[model samples]
Target: MTVILEATERRILQNPLENPEVLIRIVDDNQATCKSLQFFLEALGYEVRIWNDPELFLKEYKENEEDGCLLLDIRMPRISGLELHDILIKENFRLPIIFLTGHGDVEMAVDSVKKGAFNFLLKPSNEKKLTETIEAAVKLSIENHLKENNKTIYREVFDSLTPREKEVVRLVAQGKLNKVIAADLNITEKTVQQHRSVACHKLSVRNVAELVEFLKVLEG
Candidate 1:
């Protein structure tokens, strides 16, 4: 089966208000497919970085923490695409991921999304569709980086808390009441109350629920 991408179709997908950065990391075992897509993306004016192996890709990431989204192949030698995604997440690289796979790998592609892929496209996909998805992913990567930075800034509000208050916060997030927290920590109820008051004051949260909501953002 072939995906039709017409010559008249737009090569570019979206206009960037600010010049967007994209790093096309193609980790396909096949040289032809990798080169072909790299050519397509470069023709659209993106900075293309082709990789025939995952180790080289990981080495690049380890060296440079830069602005970009990954155009990843679903199946590759040495380190699989899904494995690379896991490694990136573990290393705190939140850039959006777009998986490319063949028709026979539909289930694997669907699983990739469940595991945090931005989107998956069929191999030999329509050129227009490919560019459109890549553009959306770059936009999403920018948004994700912004939100991650916001969370880092917000987390600083809680940094002045004592080690005990930190423990209290973790328990509060677990829905433990003050009395339960006291019993678990072997601390007096009054001390627990004092810690809660201080945490709320420093965090600028009117109540426990707001603090929980704030923590939820950090998890994302």
Candidate 2:
């Protein structure tokens, strides 16, 4: 199945200041199910945490200390999926949640969606469908991680430089733009131009914007 991310989902992923380590939590009452998802997701390069019981999962994740999305079974012992949803909010977990149910119901589905569940899936799901959904979630997690890391000193240095020498960022971000920035900074353009020539050589950026974006990732 194709994965669909609404504009809102895209924006969440695009934001640069989101949490890194958006962890994928899978909660079900079956060990086999948990293992199946965990293995598939780990193979797909996601960070996954799994639990075979709702009570235990809630116990472990008592606080909203986790990142990423949740894959929760709609039916479980101790607490039902809806109850768990309430618990998640009451505990202040802003993490997105996706529900899975062996017996899907319209009212239940509507309520869950209205309450911010990512998507609801039936049991015996297609691997492709699951994978696609996971891909969307993973993309959001990584993007947020990148954004958070980009807020560091490295990113500050990266953002502080002229838009041009950031092109020489390999050298300039490292303090190399002695001549190029001189012209840009109106000081001794030749100084960093020497540095720019070297910056261009080292950072391999044809220009500064690329250097800035690269620096953001490198800071990650």
Segments of candidate 2 deviating more than 4 angstroms: 1-22, 62-66, 141-220
Error of model 2, residue 20, in angstroms: 7.9
Q: Please provide, for model 1 over 14-129, each residue's C-alpha lDDT reduced to its tens digit, 9 standing for 90 to 100.
A: 34324445565667777898888878888887777777888788887655445567878767877887888889878876777888877337787777789888888877798889
- Most TM-score-accurate candidate: 1
TM-score, each model? 0.58, 0.55
Q: Residue 35 error for model 1, in Å?
A: 2.1
Candidate with maximal lDDT? 1
Candidate 2 weakest ten by summed lDDT: 1-10
Tell me the deviation in Å of residue 57 in model 1. Answer: 1.5
- Residue 6's lDDT within candidate 1 is 17
List all candidate RMSDs to the true structure: 10.4, 9.9
Report the backbone clash tally of model 2.
Answer: 20
